[model samples]
Structure formats: C-alpha cells, structure tokens
Target: MAEYEAKFTELSGFVPEFVNTEEKKARRFQLATKSFISRNFSNKLNLNVVPLREVLQVEIANREIIPVNQVHHRCKLKLEGKAFEVDLIPFVLGKFNMVIEMDWLSSNGVQIDCKKKKVRIRVQDGKEIMFKGQRKTHKFLTMFQTKNLLKKGNESYLAYVMDTKKEIPDIQDIPVVNEFEDVFPKDLPGFPPDREI
Candidate 1:
C-alpha cells in the first residue's frame, strides 16, 4: 500500500469520523476510491448499515466490475473542526479502513498541497482551514514484507518499540536528598524480617 501511495506525487493522509460513539474512532480515507467503508469494519462497529436496493457496478483497475450493495446514509464526518455528511458504500478493501473519493474533495473545493503535506478546505462561511499530515518517522513494515521475510527463514528483522512514560530521576540524585544523605542513603543495610521503614 505504501508503495502504491508513493507512486502518486499527491498529498496523502485523511482521517474522518465514521460513527457517533463514545470513543469517537476515526477511519482512514483513501483519496483514490469512490467513498467506501470496509464491510467487516461496518459489521464490527455494529453500524447496522443497510444495503441499497440497486447494486452499483464499480469498475476496478483490472477492468473487473464489482457489485456494491451496502450503503450507510448520512454518515457524519468531522474534518478540521467542521462536520460534513456523506453516504458511504461498504466494500472489501483489504488494508484500507475507508475511502473519501476525489469527487467529494473536488466538489467541496478541497485543495491538496503535496509539497507541504497539507489539505485546505473552505467552510460554508468562506473560511479556509489547513490540516497538516503527520510526518512518518520510519517506514512501517507491511504485511506482505513481513510474510516474505518470515518465509525466507534466515532474514534479519528489526522491531521498533515506543515508550511513552516519562523517566523520573533517582530520588538520591536530588539536591535536597544530598543534604539528608543519612535519611536517604545510596546503599541501605538489609532490614530484619519484622523491621519496617
């Protein structure tokens, strides 16, 4: 997916709210597709989305026509502090959570700045808001890459772990603790079984 995204020299990264829930989870929207939500995701979220009576035939890159039947009407999406209502069709898009098509963006007068990685959207009041894309610190290993590496059996892999907790300095290292070395000693004598500190 990263490889395909990199092929296009356009600004990427758009996340909008899909449903009204306590957690307020946001779904990723692909700029390429015709506004769609994954069928599995819809079911998992218990969106209770219903299928349209008329199935739409969607042509893919391979010239295959896929019938889309499910539609979630009037889905509220919040972007840059503004709310927009849109209808989303459910489809089986493997890694993609959802997609916001170019039609919606163009119709809404949204501007994309690839160089700056920003999206500009004009509200009803004619006020323009800029949303910046978060910079990627490192390229994440894709599922395909992981599968291939594991198949090789002798491949070297690196895992990156992030720690969010702030580290606290040792109590004995504090300036005030230096004045009370006897109370807070660097090395304390072992306490007896019944002794309490």
Candidate 2:
C-alpha cells in the first residue's frame, strides 16, 4: 500500500494524473508491454505461411467477401496469452486494421508514458533514484496514446509511430485467423542483437 502510493506520486509528477485506486484494482492482472528501438514486436510466423497448414481444411469458391469494417475477431499475444484481451476491426490504424483480439479486453487499452528526460521516483527516507520505464494505462485506446511522449523544459522524447494499418499484405486480409498455425519464426531476418528478456 505505501509502496504503490509512493510510485503513484512519482508517476503523477511526470504525467498530468494518476490512476484512481478503484481503477488500479480493476486492472491489476493486466500486463503492459511496449516496443523500444532495442525491442519491437515479434510475431514473425505471420510473415510466411505454409500450404495446407490447416489440417481440417475446406475451400469455398466465390464466397461473400466481408469488408474490413464489418469484421471483428479475437487475438492473443503469443508472449503473454494470459494478459491479452483482443478486439479486431476491419479498419487500419492509418489505413485499415482488420483483425481479432484475445478474449481479455481488460489490458489492451492501457498506456505507458516513458519519454521523461530525467525522472526520479522516491520511496523511503533518503532513497531516490532516476526513474525509467514509467507509464500508465487508459483503457481501450490503441498505441496512439502511448506515442504521446513527455516534453519538459528543452528536452523531449516524443516520437509518433506510423498509422501502420497501411496497405497490409493480402494474407492478413483473411476474414478469420486462428492461433492454430500462427507461430513466430525462431529465426527472423533483420533481427537485432539479443537483449535481456
């Protein structure tokens, strides 16, 4: 209880507000993650798909094509399946993003604000250190909310991500996706050096 209050105070100094006690209780189980230059998203099994992967396969010719707007589904993050609550829409972020999310929607909308130039978190008497990786969640918003980095004094680390629902591959256009055959590639091209997990 005391620890959270101290961290909350530290977070409030960097941002305009702090999450309410009830909100925190409601969201305690949801895990938050972010992509950094050192580490980005890695669901590479998405890049290449093999033929006849679906063992119980059936093909239909000339079925009704559903536009991206009319579709929504579930998705799960391979790294943290227990924490992901997904909702898919046939609309892109910048263009059109169509996909499903996992069953849990509790954690998807939270945001973390870590653009502070030099922030500090103080705990007990005579214990304070430069704080890093400080962020908060605003339930249901996309990564857009996270991109709004901090700007203080003459220093700022604000960087906007691409509205990546741009022209996506035809494969992703699939109206429905299943985790059955989807796997991240063990070895991916253009991968950076290993970082601590």
Candidate 3:
C-alpha cells in the first residue's frame, strides 16, 4: 500500500476557525430516549413486540447527530409500542443519493412517507432482513437486489423488485397565465413610452 502525505507551503490562520464552525454545525443534535420511558419492563404490555411486517411506518423524533466515529444524523423512532433509534442513513446507488427522506412533522413526531421513493426493509425470521426499493423510479432497485442475493426469503421476490420505466411521459398539463397588458400605458399618444432617461 502506498502512503500519501499533504504538504502545505503556506498555512492560513482562518483554516482552523472554518473547520471549528463546520464541526459545531454537524454535532448540533444528540439522540436521547432511555429517560422518557418510565413504565416497568415486567409488564407484558410495555414490552409489546412491534409487528415486523414487510413494511412499517414509524414516527421519528429528536433529530440528532449519531456519534459513530464520525457525526451521523439519527432520530428517536416510535413504531407502535416500541421506541427505537434509527440512523438517517440513505440507501446509496452508484453515484446517486436516491433515498427515502425522513422528516419531523412537529413536537418530536417523525414520520416516514413511503409514497415517494419507497424504502422496503424485508424481515426474514425476525432477525435477518433486506432493505429494498419498492418503486419503479428508484435507481437502486437493481443494485439492492444484487447486493442482498438470496435464493429464497420470506418476502416475495416480485413484491419489491420493479421494472425500469420504458419512456417518460410528455408534459400534458401546464399552468399558463396571461400577461397584464394594461399595467402601463403602451406608448400612448405622444408620451414617448416612458423612456428611461
């Protein structure tokens, strides 16, 4: 393995200042969840198992930087009765960052809208599962399948995979607004059209 070194002829004082500011911005939020739950674990209802269905909608809360050697955006999640910590890591495809963006609606309420760019996390025997793209336009549909190559899983093969779109539909409906003709008198009579002097 070849080692490389960066040699700088001139070092600017502002370099440290700029780096400090960017670091602060990245580590703004911290995910905290253990404190909130006051219920006893012995109660069977409190330890209710969240149904690990093919797809589940979870409300995300407390958007904070997940400290994993480096700063990563993560959030507190609530799925049915269970509270979990989910890292906001997008599924990458080649050079594109096509992802399912999670947004916080209000007051620690984070919801995942699966209608656009669907994110499918298929569960197999409770532990093992695969994350897949459920939409046709998802760029990672093929890549996701290739990465998690399984002969047979609990999730149907045809359910998550989708065929690429053959052709883009032409723009059919476009909003057209008429120009205000009488806003200014159009070169009326002898008034030299309000010339900019």
Candidate 4:
C-alpha cells in the first residue's frame, strides 16, 4: 500500500487518502442510492448524479473514447477552502464531444454535475476550471471535422442520426401545386399584395 501510494502520488501529484472499510461502505451506499434515484427520476424530477459516466455511457459512437479512470481517481483529492491552479487540457474525443483532463496538480478538488454534463475543478493558486462535455451529431462525411478543421463532401451522410424518426405533419405548410403561379392563389389567404398595398 505504501508503494502504491508513492507511485500514485508521483503519477498524480496528490497523496492518496486511505479510507477505512466502514467509510468505503458508506460512500458506496451513497453512490448506489444516488444512482438509483438518477436512473428512475432523472427526466421526471430533474435529479442529477455526480460523475456523469456512472449513469450514462459517455463515449463516441465509432471512435475510441478515453476512460474516466484517471479523472475519477484524481477527484478524490480534497483541500477544503484552499485556492489552487488547475492544469486543464481540453480535447476532442469521440465524434464532436469534448473531454477535459486535470491531473498535474496536488490537493485538487473536482465537482461533477451530471445534469449539466459538466466538470468543475479546483486546484492550487485560486484558480478554477470548468468545462462541459459535448454531444453533437455530424454528417458521416464531416464527422471527423472539428472547429479547427474543414472538409468538403456529401453533407447528407450523417454521422449520427436521431434515434426516432420525425412525425409526419398532418397539415402541410405550403399547398402542393404543379407550378409556383398555381400555388399563389390557392396557398395564400389572398393574392400577395404588391408593394405592401
């Protein structure tokens, strides 16, 4: 355990805390309760849990997604009311989504807002880092393109399509006609006034 702590501290820059079995059991029970509540009442009650990955599968559809093991492990750092500087790295992960990393500081703290899909970190030196995870659909041809890159291709090919099809409208906004001229009189309440008269 001492060697593990030394290595963890060396790699993470934070000394790990050793929790007793009773404390571990209590934390696990709390997490389980929160998970149950979030799963059953998230949409209806707007309840959120911490570390979003716990309740949702956060990853790209086709690309490799980095695991949250590091973030989860580092989040255990706690220096209450201490000002700190965070080393945050924002990168594009699967699809158009973003993942933030902060593992270069000691005695850092992290807060995860599952409802907002955001992570907030407090490091040494009175600094705070906050970021949101991105989840946007893209065209199949443009899936790999990011804000820094541009690509030209078939825009119809979708990288991610809606899970459900759009419902067909019962009434059409425009009247179906053979020609534009035919559409005018039938489609409009009255012939469009010329010059607003």
Candidate 5:
C-alpha cells in the first residue's frame, strides 16, 4: 500500500487516498474508486471521463466480481509533491481508493521499499520524492462488508437527515467555472437569433 496525496481538477483540491501497488497485475491500466470520484468531483467539466463500450470485469481479494465501464483520461495526480498525468478507470475497491499498477510504476521510475515501507518516485528533474506508507488499522465501520452482510440475510438502509440550509458557494468562486469563464458568462445575452444547422 503506497498511500499518498492525489490532486485532481475535478476534485477541486488534494485528497489523501490509499494507493495499492500490485506487481503481478498483468494489465497496465490504473483504477480509482467510484465513490472517490463521485464524492470529490462534483463538477463534470473538469473531469475527462469516457464510458467504455465493453465493460471490464475485475476480481478482488474475496473473488467478488466488479464491472468497470468508465475511464478518466489524463487525470492529474499529485503524489507526494510531484505531479503526474494518468488514466484511471472507475472501480469499486471497498476500502482502497486507487490502484497503481506495475507498468506505470516501472515506466515512471518508481521504487518501492517493502522493508522501509516507502515509495520513491524519480521526477523529470532527477529529484526523488519519498512517500511513507501508513500502517493499516482496523476501523469498525470500514470493516463491515455491506454486500456480504446483506447476502447473509442482514438488512441495511441509508438513514440521513437533510440539511436544507447548507450554504452554496458563489458561481464566481467556483474554480472549474472560473477556469472557463468564457463558457459560463456572468450575464447571458437577451437572446440569440434562430439559425439553421
């Protein structure tokens, strides 16, 4: 587990997420959690997501199958302090947030020290950024397998109280909209003349 801070324009900021590195994975493509994407990336304009025609099936630790059909291209990921552009497929990883395959690591000159629990990345400037791995701790909430529990005749329901008075950020303050100011004009013209395609 080579956890690090990842930044994304869609996310609108940096987030601490667990990144799993698998050397034996045959595929080179990386994966990001669907929950992570939905939770952080509320603005679609900043996301370069594409739906795949053919869904890919992946088996996790418990042999549960997860179908993947979306890919986020050229996503900006800031690991440690160095930035990187990567393609990530949306996945259902339970507790993990992302997966860093071996191909990407090898190509990017990333070295992992298992004994030291550190990940070293060599950047373009020949400088190395080191990320220390966090020790795994069992959290009661995270340990619950909802799907499995439900399969065993257990019941589950989402319970939440809505906060209707939550303050919404001003349109001008939105980073994504600000980036494309031309697209989202502060004031739209009265009307446009009807034109034929």
Candidate 6:
C-alpha cells in the first residue's frame, strides 16, 4: 500500500462571535435515565418497547433557547415525579424559534413545529398519526415507515423512527457519546504541495 500524506485547509467561512469573544459558540450534552433502563431489566416491563397501547396525550416539559445570547430555559412544568430534561439546540428552521426540541431518552423524542406550536413525536410500537400536510414523515430517525399528515389531531402520535423525510435535520454531531476532552488537535503535521507536476 502506498503511504499518503494528509493535509487539511479551510476555504473560508463565517462563525458567530459573541461580543468579539473568541469562544466556540456551541457545545453538546445528553440526558439518559438509569431509572428507565431498570424497568426493562426488572421482573415485568419490557424496556425494549414503551407501552403505547392506551397511552396518549403525552405531557412534556417544553424547552426553548435564544440564539443571539445562547440562553435556555424549561417551560416550568413543575410536575411531581420524574423530571425530564429537554434538549434546546440551535437550528435554522426558518426563524430562531426552532429552539426547544426532543425529550431525552424517552421511548420517542419530541420535535415541536414552532409556527404550528404542535409537537412531533414517535411511539414504541404504534404507527404514524397525521396532523397537517399531505406529506408527513416517519416517527424518529430510525427504522420505521413514513406517512403524510393530512388531517388534524389534538395530540399527534407516532412510532419511533425518522423513516423518511427529504429534509430531516442533521443531528448526528449534536449529541455526546464518549469521553470529553477539552483539547483539540493542533499539532498534526502538514504535507508539502507538489510543484513539479
């Protein structure tokens, strides 16, 4: 195998700088439940699937964020028992209102259509329930089928998987999955450009 030299360069781009501060504008975080997992291991409830046979009208603690200042807050759902952490990531979905999204580690995550003020989610074993457009997508970003939301329902229900959607949000890089290291690669060797071609 021929050895190859690696070199990297950036053509140019714009990055948001707050108050002329030289800080990376974004970070990633996560919320998982050891409690939710126990139910799957214990003597009865199968954690592999969330029982959605009769459960509907899911109560969620909505979250929202301000992009300019990069601030976040919960919807003040002072529910007694089981406090859930909602992820408020910055996204360019038309306006800045695409702030609060997805409840962490739930059977199905939540995505709110800011303009519609309606929530999008998925069920464990349930099918997709329509809400509006003639073309609707799947539950979450996983193995499931997609459909259209031609009708309106008070609370839309779905199965967990973003089976289809031509414009699904790119979310793979926003969540943390391993150890956190503060340092970045700054000492990588560069390759010389070939000038004798």
Candidate 4 TM-score to native:
0.22
Candidate 4 lDDT, 64-164, residue by residue in tens: 33333112212222335544332211223324222223233222467888899987776556577787988877654343554235444433433676657
TM-scores for candidates 1 onward, in order: 0.50, 0.19, 0.18, 0.22, 0.47, 0.20
Candidate 6 deviation (Cα RMSD): 29.7
How well does candidate 1 match the true structure, expressed as C-alpha RMSD?
Answer: 15.1
lDDT-wise, the better of 3 and 5 is 5
Instruction: Give candidate 5's TM-score.
Output: 0.47
User: How much lDDT does each candidate structure score?
Assistant: 0.72, 0.35, 0.34, 0.41, 0.64, 0.32
Residue-by-residue lDDT tens digits, candidate 3, 29-85: 321211112123213223332322233222232332222221123334543434445
Question: Where is model 3 more than 4 Å wrong at Cα?
Answer: 1-9, 20-126, 134-197
Q: Which window of 10 residues has the lowest lDDT sum in candidate 5?
A: 27-36
The residue pairs in collision within model 5 are none
Q: Which ranking of candidates, highest lDDT first?
A: 1, 5, 4, 2, 3, 6
Candidate 5 lDDT at 169 equals: 69
Ranking by TM-score: 1, 5, 4, 6, 2, 3
Instruction: Give the range of the ten consecutive residues with the poorest summed lDDT in model 1.
Output: 22-31
For every model shown, the clashing-pair count is: 0, 22, 1, 12, 0, 6
lDDT of 1 by residue, 1-197 (tens): 88776753233323222222343212112224358888887788666577787777765545455877778988877877789977788887778888778888888899999999999998899999898999867567788878886887957757798676967668766788767867876676788479577
Cα lDDT for residue 155, candidate 4: 38
What's the C-alpha lDDT at position 172 in model 6? 42
Better of 4 and 6 by TM-score: 4
lDDT string, candidate 2, 1-197, tens digits:
99998997888777643434555434322212111110012122232212221221111123222222121223343322233323322222322222222222213332223566444433334444453553566665455544443222344455788878887545345545424225444356676889999
